[model samples]
Target: MYLTPSMAKLVHEFNKLPGIGPKTAQRLAFHILKISATEARVLASAIIEVKDRITNCPICYNITEDSPCSICKDTTRDHGLICVVEQPSDIIAMEKTRVYKGDYHVLQGAISPLDGIRPDNLRINELLMRIQQEKVKEIIIATDSDVEGEATALYLERLLRTMVARVSRIAHGIPIGSNIEYTDEVTLSKALESRRIL
Candidate 1:
């Protein structure tokens, strides 16, 4: 299929994004072509605006328009507890729960030796600095359940034990509504391990 030069270029750009296959990129490019010029310009402008305005928070490494980010500046949140996560998106997921009212430290990426991501590649040093400077009493490792995330969490837990008063990993279990019979062995094991007395 010979797409117009402009459409081909747009598809190529879209394909550069993670998880966007060539077919999906072509579809997106065609969809963009169908949209009005003004609407397309608005979309383009929004992308440019995010690139121009967003910067990592100085304290937590979360993406924000401001230096410290709103969470770091908030006086009502718990300053003595810091939840560690692999990315800024993780912070968003945690915040959506509305239960945790603590500070965060975005590691920016998890430890994955196979992918060449190491402790130095992330914001681990910055997190350590924050722990030393701030009155952080508890450090919660909230990395994902994958191999890299688990490795990152374990590494952080060990490193933070002597530094912080308490270091704990977030409990991994079967999701709330999921059926026990359908749950995988690892998830079942984790759920059992994290079972509460209540």
Candidate 2:
């Protein structure tokens, strides 16, 4: 069965998304075609709304509608302690737990030489600036347990040794090769509780 030009285009666009294959994209396009026009409009509008409203928090670089974001602005949170993470999505995962009430700083991405992503490509400079500006007592390196995450953690540890009072790494409750995004709230909370000094 030959697909029309518009359907083929939609499939191609969906295929560009992470984890979406050509077959899945085609199936998704067909599903979209079967959905009501009003439903499609709602989906399209939601996508547009996110693009229009969501912007990076200037302080932590987390995705937010406001400048500094609620976490950064919340006085109830520990201002001296900051949790460092690779992506904004990891913040959502961490928040599911009862532990960890400190603020967060999103690195945006990890350092991967093979991927041509260096420390400069992340928010390391911004983090350093923040540390200098604030009385940051400690920084928890909450990058994933993968090789890239480990390398990034080591690099950050070395870089942040003298800059801050202390630096820590989240514990091994999260299995190697497993991402924090998929980790359960219990495991994530335990990991934070058992974090080791770096």
Candidate 3:
């Protein structure tokens, strides 16, 4: 069956999003059609507004409508400690925990040789500059536990060792409620390796 040209275009656009298959795109287009015109307009306006207004913070590269994001402007956060992450979303996740009371450095992307993403493609130079200029005392590598993340963490470790700060990797282990049977081998190994007597 042939969809109307506009509806077909909407489905195609939705399909371009990450993890959105053709079927899912079609479903989303139809769902949007079912919504009130005002609500749909609001959604479209929000998307446009974000693309139009959002800009990366100059200091940390986190996405925000302002030059320096609210986090950077906040005086209570520990500027001496920086948590390095692979993406802006990862910073959001860490902030949601409300336990990390420090600044952040968003790499924007990871170094994945398979995808031709190298160190130059990320914000590594900015991080090093920040460390040197700010006299940062601690760096927490909060990159993912995957191969790329691990490689980035190791690279940062060596780089920061020569600086005036202590560097540490975030500990990995099992989730609070996850069962041992469902846990991955890497997590199990890390948990055992970082085990504490307490």
TM-score for each predicted model, relative to the true structure:
0.96, 0.86, 0.95
At residue 35, what lDDT does model 3 achieve?
100
Question: Would you list the clashing residue pairs of candidate 3?
Answer: none
Please identify model 1 stretches exceeding 4 Å from their true place.
Answer: none
lDDT string for model 2 (101-184, tens) is: 999999999989999999999999999999999999999999997888999999999999998889998766887899999999
Clashes per model (N, Cα, C within 3 A): 0, 0, 0
Task: List pairs with backbone clashes in candidate 2.
Answer: none
For every candidate, C-alpha RMSD to the true structure in Å:
1.1, 5.7, 1.3
| lDDT, candidate 3, 1-198, per-residue tens | 689999999999999999999999999999999999999999999999999999999999999988799998899999999999999999989999999999999999788999998888899999988987896999999999889999988888887797855899899899999999899998899899999998
**Per-residue lDDT over 20-89 for candidate 1, one digit per residue giving the tens place of the 0 to 100 score:** 9999999999899899999999999999999999999999999999878999999999999999998898
- Between candidates 2 and 3, the one scoring higher on lDDT is 2
Candidate 1 lowest-lDDT run of ten: 153-162
Global CA lDDT of candidate 3, please?
Answer: 0.91
